[model samples]
Target: MAERTYDVMILGAGASGMMCAAQLNEKSDLSVVVIEGNEKAAKKLKVSGGGKCNITNVNVSASNYLGDEQLIESIFSQFSKEDLLLWLEHRGLKPVLRKEQYYFCPKSSEEIIEILKAASAKSDYKFGEEIISLSKEEHFVLKTKKRKYKAKNVVIATGGKSFGSLGASEIGLELAASLGHESISFLPALAGFTLQKNAFWMKELSGISFEAEVTVAGKTLYEDMLLTHKGLSGPVVLSASLYWSKGEISINFLPKNNLVDLLHNNRRLLSTALPLPKRFTQAFIVHLGIKDRACVDYKNDERALLVSAFHTYHLAPAGTYGFSKAEVCKGGVKTETLNSWTLESNILENLFFAGEVVDITGELGGYNFQWAFSSGVVAAQHIIENNKV
Candidate 1:
């Protein structure tokens, strides 16, 4: 019933909204407000990188990304690992690199949250406001469950549907539709696959893990393999789910070594290079249908058959855990309607989209968070530059 006022109001206090607020300095001369529907910001952040919060990746590049390829590349080019490292340092947190693959907070994801939260110090926000509608006049009127707040500009920084249990839902996409902005249907990415055919091995080997090379179609990702009660998990399979994964994927239970060579060496000396439990190894050998022929006694065709099994193992996955277990949602705001440099909506002036709400979704690791941060920064700066704030 009463009218509240502000200069800039951002919707969704997830990674992008938080980073967007953080980027607007106290000197911006405009009042900034953030409306969040959740109890706290970045509920997903708390568990990222298994609580360590892989804050960013040192190998961030267009090649490692999916979505609107050109737009993603253009936007990310404006921010680099250096910028993020400096940003973290400014927040008094250091990002540590692990094996040229992932960068993480040395303390924990909670520490990363502390840093980003510190960055939002200058901006004001409503932590429990659930925005229901918006109307733009000379100023924008934002309707939430509790009240109506007016602002000159609004940013849809709510993330995509990933883990609904953690507040990852289709709310952003629905809001975009309400705003007259087009959004792409989203699918779960970075999730493990569950097979239609129950894998007897998975149940038998529920607690087993091994270093493995998993390939789907032709793409390959190498990492540790974990056996779950339902199916397979771990870094390699999760990443593989991004691209090669579909109805089925080919997995090399044994990688980088021919069965012939391994057998040849281990058979005569009775040494073991099969790094799994002896029982599992025996199972593997049995599944390959290789009975006790001495490794050298194998005929050429038998050697070839053994080689194929070790090199190309495959099975169809029934489905995934869907959004609740996904690390990132795959699709979002159709990239064709956005300005890469500014993240401005092509159909609507003074309305902007950022973070996972856009079609640009990144792979597992801190890449998605970094994209959220960079995109938010670009959108806020653009809004400011255009005097929309």
Candidate 2:
């Protein structure tokens, strides 16, 4: 049989791959094909955000990501979240804003998927073909378990290794490495942390959640924190995990109230005066090795200790919950090796990268998806301009 060939071939039919193919179809007449390992496309998109995918966020900036800030800023400038919303709105899919920040599909993730499918109607799709190897000579050659294919330009949209069940892998990173590009190994991001032995008492307060502030790696995030069987998991902790590699994280159990002011002249028990969940406060008081007594009975040193314990609780996490529970993965092909404007590899000609595969991971919310879409469009636009007939 004859091997398939195309002007451009995109790996992974996830958010980035589909967006790139859609852009190419809209702006250029190049023969485009999307190759996906899964039987269908957008497997992760279909399940993300509990089926109603978070399309983008109200506030999007380079600060929301853990990567080359300048590169991210460049990409966002070219295709900002506003551009994304306009693109979707023009396609008759208006994402609804949830929690006054995140924009989610009003109905389901399928809404956006269908729009992408329609936009890329001119492109061909080869599903259930897992790429075994990729090599470039005159044209890039890709081999799958089923057959071989070739393309003039290739976009590695193969995403990070987060949802392994959804067919996520480090193939994109591996491919870039084979072509002489440096990359950091992927690690779990936006995931919960397992407690160290000293923090095991937190497990006893499982199911308790409260609004608090978490400070790690010089960044502070205020959001709901959940105490779980493992240790801690919630928006604040997950966001903090993005910056936390090692060392202690500070958690303010009462971020809104001043511990000193709350304790002043109050005669109530420590557990009842702090305005936190009784169970959590009791556990915390016990863990701190301080007797649970009337607030007025505490000495000056004890008051200072209580104040610090409530406002600047510090603990080191053993590790993360691993990729199985991770929403995204950090570290991939370093951004230094790619064109900031186009996401094209400086090391190899005709090679581009987009989405999670490019070493840019966003905190929990819609930032990751926004990055996927923005990077995809930027790469596709460059390809279209270069391949113009």
Best-fitting candidate, scored by lDDT:
2
Against the true structure, candidate 1 reaches a TM-score of 0.92
TM-score of each: 0.92, 0.97
Q: 1-389, model 2: which lDDT tens digit per residue?
A: 77767999999999999999999999999999899999999998999888999999999999899999999999999999999999999999999988799899999999999999999889999999998888998899998899888999999999999879999988998888889999999999999999999999999989999999999999999989999999899989999999999999999999999988887898999888888998888888888888888888888998898889889989899999999889999999999999998999998888999999998999888999999999999999999988877
Evaluated at residue 13, the lDDT of candidate 2 is 95
- Candidate 1 lDDT score at position 98: 87
lDDT (Cα atoms) of all candidates against the true structure: 0.76, 0.93
Off by over 4 Å in 2: none
Across 120-225, the per-residue lDDT of candidate 1 in tens digits comes to: 8777768778777887777878788898888877788888888877766677777678767777799887887776554555656777787788767566778877
Candidate 1 Cα outliers beyond 4 Å, as residue runs: 265-277, 292-294
Worst 10 residues of 1 by lDDT: 267-276
Model 1: lDDT to the true structure: 0.76
